[model samples]
Target: MMKIHEIRELIKLIDQSTINEFEYEENGAIVKMKKGVDAQVVSTFVPAPVAKQEIIAQPTVTSVATIEKIVEEPKAAEEVAKVEDANLHKITSPMVGTFYSSPSPDAANYVSVGDKVNDSSIVCIVEAMKLFNEIEAEVQGEIVEVLVKDGQLVEFGQPLFLVKA
Candidate 1:
């Protein structure tokens, strides 16, 4: 079982970091925190006797304000991207990780708007657990949009690029 002080420390770290969600589990205990419009910190414990659960909604005043601001920025950006490329082929992330447009910080991006790509072409890289995996364009087309910013965390099936197939 994690102490309240430890949990408070975890929350502080999350608020200071770029991580939007965090999960920790140990000895039948699970702690999960997610930042958003209605940010929440949930902790669950399962005992051997039967099935027991508890959910605590403790959002700090400062955290709530910060979370709303963080959430709003992303929504605004996504809306613009969707409006501009409503009819394009979306290349989504295959796994959760940080999205990188170029191979290196100083290198050129693998694909840019108006660039032609085939099914085998490398479009970007998704870094997961210290490993950088090259993402391919499964559809042959000209790139019409880049949905995610470089170094942004992306989830599985999240749109990375829009291709005009």
Candidate 2:
């Protein structure tokens, strides 16, 4: 479980980064943070089974100046591409883990950019707590982009690939 100060620090880091959402989970505890319109910050917490409590924090304005600064920075080319591609389907991580593009070091990648994938196609593997979870494409499409590099730590709901359906 994360302490309140740790969560606040995470929120601050996220506010300063380009990421729009962040999630952390451990031992049945979960914390999620999302940036909303007007620079609002929303947080949700699910405690462990022993606690069995759900806590939702009210939207808070930590630093309006920082938020304004973030808004003023120009979007990069990749960011623009993501925004303009309306037909792209994002394949997101279902759990927090280390992402692997291949089954093993010597094995070929499951999928790559421009590869066609069906609903059951294995796209990647996410290893959490020593368990490798195979992630499927769920949507039939051509993969247009690979969002994360191999062995990167990914959070839940983090975009992993962009597919053109």
Candidate 3:
């Protein structure tokens, strides 16, 4: 069974993270939890090495084990690409909204493919409830691809861009 303190620590991590839903099984103990709109969305990016280290070294401190994770194990060949993506950093949406690649329709895009972005770089904008939220790269690396197009409606925690870190 999962310990009460471990469960509490998981809740604390979720409350301050973009992942509203989480599930994990550790030591044969299963746990699942979700959050409402009150979940805090952080705009900072973590590099692959440090992020992976955190996942292994600090299970009780990180948001969830689902960071860029596939819920199921697949046997298809397409999964090879997914395996390759394991080293990439994914900048995800904080809320359900429209994904905009630029500040305005007439302006140039915030960051395109092959563009190098820093921790504070604004990669795109998510328009939710008439408010435009600037989504930051948070990870310093080259933008591998823009997963969503302008005016595209995206869900909360949806992957927006893949960065090669």
**lDDT tens readout by residue for model 1, 62-153:** 57787677657766887897776776888999888999999999999999999999999999999999999999999999998899999999
Give TM per candidate: 0.50, 0.53, 0.54
* Candidate 2: segments with Cα more than 4 A from true spot: 1-83
lDDT values for all models: 0.87, 0.86, 0.83
Among all candidates shown, the one with the greatest TM-score: 3
Which portions of model 3 miss their true places by more than 4 Å? 1-79
Residue ranges of candidate 1 with Cα displaced over 4 Å = 1-86
lDDT of 3 by residue, 31-103 (tens): 8887766656666534235232222332343445542233232334347887869989999998889999999
Alpha carbon lDDT at 56, candidate 3: 32
lDDT of 1: 0.87
User: In terms of lDDT, which candidate is stronger, 1 or 3?
Assistant: 1
Tell me the alpha-carbon RMSD of every candidate: 20.2, 20.2, 21.3
Model 2, range 115-136, lDDT digits (tens) per residue?
Answer: 9999999999999989999999
* Residue pairs with backbone overlap in model 2: none
- Residue 142 alpha-carbon offset, candidate 2, angstroms: 0.2
Give the winner by TM-score: 1 or 3.
3
